[model samples]
Target chain A: MAALGFAALFNVPARCLPIIFLFGAVGIFVKLLLLLFGINIVFACLAGAAAIGFLSIPAAHYKHAPPLIFYIPAVIPMVPGIMAYRMMLGLIKLTESTQTLNYNTVLFETVNNGLKVLFILISLSVGVIVPMLLMRKESIKHVRVPFSKK
Target chain B: MDQAIKSVRREEMKQLGKVLLKAGTMLMSAGANTGRIRNTINRIASAFDYSVELHISQRALSLTIMDEEESSFVSKLRRTPPHVINFTILSGISKMSWNIVQDNWSSEQILADLERLEKMPHYHRWMVLSLVGLAGAGFCALANGSPMDLLFTFLASFLGLFVRQEAVKANFNPYLAIYFAALTASLIAGGAVKLGLGHADSYAFVTSVLFLIPGVPLINSFSDIIDGNIQNGITRGVNALVISFSIALGIFTSTFIYQFQ
Candidate 1:
């Protein structure tokens, strides 16, 4: 999964293997840090996003390719796909209970999953967007080729 | 006078070569992993005084150059008249393509090699698409859904391939492409759920959308800002957000319509 994400991110016509591997290793470290600090998934995601953003600077400076390849894979583990599925299931079960099933437990589970997906999406977006906006003024200059003297 | 004319033409050719190189680099970089080529060409072009006509083809980078015409007849005889120099740069990025050590090659040689590589046949586009599909499938499976949900997810993934291919061909706004894709995927999922495919349909929908996430750009933008690349960071951030929002809007629209119905 990480490899696919890396390939998708790099999606360019050059050698980004080194960059991908380096970012992947750093991502594991960030996950470790999150575990050690006992941070919730939302905060952990934010921390991971920040770490990836910080680590990508050198690669961007040295390489003209965008730093996205490194950063995207680092956050793949926390994207809330499962939670989203659960939310859908919950909604369906809730609807079923109200119709003919009369199952309160299904209703409760559905609500819980729906709320979880919402919270996760909100937090993930906040974690990603806040740091990005805060550091907006720091992007590297694209390498401009010198124009020849006529 | 003849000797002077020859010297001027020689200088013009050198400048023309530089322009073609620069144009080629730009086109190649627009595709993928050719940053070094782009930089090298930019450097060489900066040293010349020529206009460049860059064409980005689906398979290769084509460039045409026109030298600035001399004002005086004497100067015209002494230098080459402004004219087009056409050349193509191949995109040499494939699983089979390996990078030679930069230390062993001069910058000019590297540029030449990249230009050569651009002409080599590689499966970069297909490889990227295949990987994306595989990952989307893997994510869907991991979500622990029923087989029906998995099939729906796979269909969504297949749809994504068409979206990406169209986006690349159109050079349309990546954000717009992402949003449309998201909406389409969500709609399909919602319909499936509504039709009694089980709650797994929604999971399939969300998991499939995962394949379209601009995860890399979001990360890259943040990294660029932290590293003091304010302009690059901001541009990338905006671009990434546009795509993300597009995906979100797609979901919102689909959900809204589904609910309304």
Candidate 2:
């Protein structure tokens, strides 16, 4: 539902919504499954996004649309929105109070959440784009060139 | 006669240049990454036996289209419209570029198709509001908010997005609209928490404004940098950071207002 809503918000073509839903569902499932095994959250997100990225080529071929349309909204649901919010709130709190005790805790929360948001975002974007780039290279190499040597 | 041929070649170059610029602007404004935009334009130009050199920045595109013989080319620049996330237009033009290559479309035909695409309908306002609101609630639920939290989140984001739409329509700066939307959402959620309405008011408060996250810009910025479009990538990254700051300020204001209560 989150993916579908974002797809709509992005004005994705109506025909591609189902693929978005599929990618979203599968991506989250993979992440959750990895989390159940005690995997780190950042690595789990990476794995999930890689799953969606690998699936995007086939999905794009099937729909004849750009692979990006399928994965962008799907990957969004995995973004650490709450972490970003908490980080922002923590930063704000730090500014309001300068006492050493409160300052240390607020600073810790701010840094912790900030670092997690940064790494998770990096993992998500890298995980999704790297596979597409790899697969895309293979497809490009297969294109028939006129008068090419056998 | 030679002069006549030169003039004709110039006219042809000019026409083709216009077409390339139009296509580039559409893709850029639709939030496509720089590589895709460049690749698509190159593909379309190659179909017409021309090679293109393109420079894409955050606000404008500069294009030079040269014939196979490297004679009688045109160079043109066009400013892109404000960035909007419209994947339909992006996908439409991409598919059309492929079709152009396969079917050998004329410039006139391509222009006609572009005209058709420019008129594509967006989702109705009501649909976007409700769906985005639900997306916010979904985010809240994912954070383990209770049912009451979800309900308030839905209401908060619904009104927040509505305010954003109206603000955009009223010609406010886009960042200001985002700030207003985030403020509205956080205030609503904070109010619910203050009133003792939900078990997980903090979750609702934090997640109700997640709809405003600049996911596309942030992701595209990273993609652009990876693809070596460093200038474009940095500009987009800064844009995303500014938007994040706006959202944070909005949330901060509401939190500050309610924390003493």
Candidate 3:
């Protein structure tokens, strides 16, 4: 549902929505499963994004659309929005802090959240693109939409 | 006879160049990354026994198309249309390009197809708004927001996206539309916080505006830079930054008002 919403918001072709939903669900499930196993959050995010990127190749080949149209919307749900929100809020709080101790605490919290957001974003982007890099030859196969005639 | 044939060939090259430029600009403005644009266009050109070199920037595309012999070429530059995330067009063109190659389409046929692709309709406005609102609620749920927080997020984001659509229709700058949407979402969520209606008011406040995050542009920026499209990457990055700043400002404004009240 989250992926569908983003796919719609981005005006993704109607036909691609279900696939995006599947990929999105798969990504989140992977991230959560890895988290359950005590994996680092950044690595977890990278794994999830890589899963989506790999899924996108066959999907894109079948659908005759670029892999980006598939993976971009799916990856969005894992974008660490809450962390960024906390970082921004922490920044706001830091500005309002008076005492040195309070300022230091807020500053630390802000930086931590900010760095996490940064690393997660990097991992997600790199994860999505790595498959394309590794399988560039496979990604370029000709596609024919199964139901379409000429 | 030779002069006439040369003239006719040049005309065909010009027409093909125009078609390629139009397609490239459409893909670029529709939020396709640099590599896809170049690859798709190149694939289409190759079907016509020609090849192309594309120079893509943030808002423009420069294309040079050459025949097999490289005796003559057609070069043209066109400004990309405003960026709107329309994967339908991206998908449509991708499919159409492959079809062109397979069917051996003429430049005229490709132009006709491009025209048809341009007119494809988006999902209905209300559906998009409601679904995006629900998406915000979903995000809130993922964040462990309370049920009341989910309701607040849904309502806030629904109205916020509505405001954004209307603001865009009113010809407001795109960043300004985002600012307005953020302000609307935050204001509604902030009001709920003040009213003490939700156990996770802050969650609602944060997640309601999550819909406005420019996730695609930011991610595309990273991809672009990694692909060595540094100028385009930096431009998109800065664009996303400005948008984030706008969102933060709007949220901050509402938070300041409600905190004092």
Docking class of 3: medium
How many residue pairs clash in all the candidates, one count each?
25, 0, 0
Q: CAPRI verdict on model 2?
A: medium
Which is the better candidate, 1 or 2, if ranked by lDDT? 2
DockQ for all models, in order?
Answer: 0.18, 0.60, 0.56
> Model 2, range B1-261, lDDT digits (tens) per residue?
999987887787788789889989999999899999999999888887789999999899999988888866788999999888999999999889888887888888898899899899999989999999988888887888999899999999999999998999999999999999999998998899889896643888888888998989988999999999999989999999999999988888898788722
Give the distance in Å from residue B232's predicted Cα in candidate 1 to where it truly belongs.
1.9
Q: Which candidate is the best by DockQ?
A: 2
Residues A52-114 of candidate 1 have per-residue lDDT tens digits of 656665564455444544445545645676665565546645654555455767777777776
Across B76-118, the per-residue lDDT of candidate 3 in tens digits comes to: 9999888888999888998888788788899999999899989
Point out the worst 10-residue segment of candidate 3 chain A by lDDT: A141-150
Name the runs in model 2 displaced over 4 angstroms.
A141-150, B1-6
* Candidate 2 clashes between residue pairs 3 or more apart in a chain or in different chains: none
- Tens-digit lDDT track for model 1 on B120-201? 4444666656666666665666666677777776666657766755865687665677777777777776677778884633
How large is the C-alpha RMSD of every model relative to the true structure? 10.6, 2.2, 2.7
TM-score of every candidate: 0.53, 0.96, 0.95
Worst 10 residues of 2 chain B by lDDT: B198-207
- Give lDDT tens digits, candidate 2, residues A3-69: 8889999999999999898898899999999999999999999999999998988888788788889
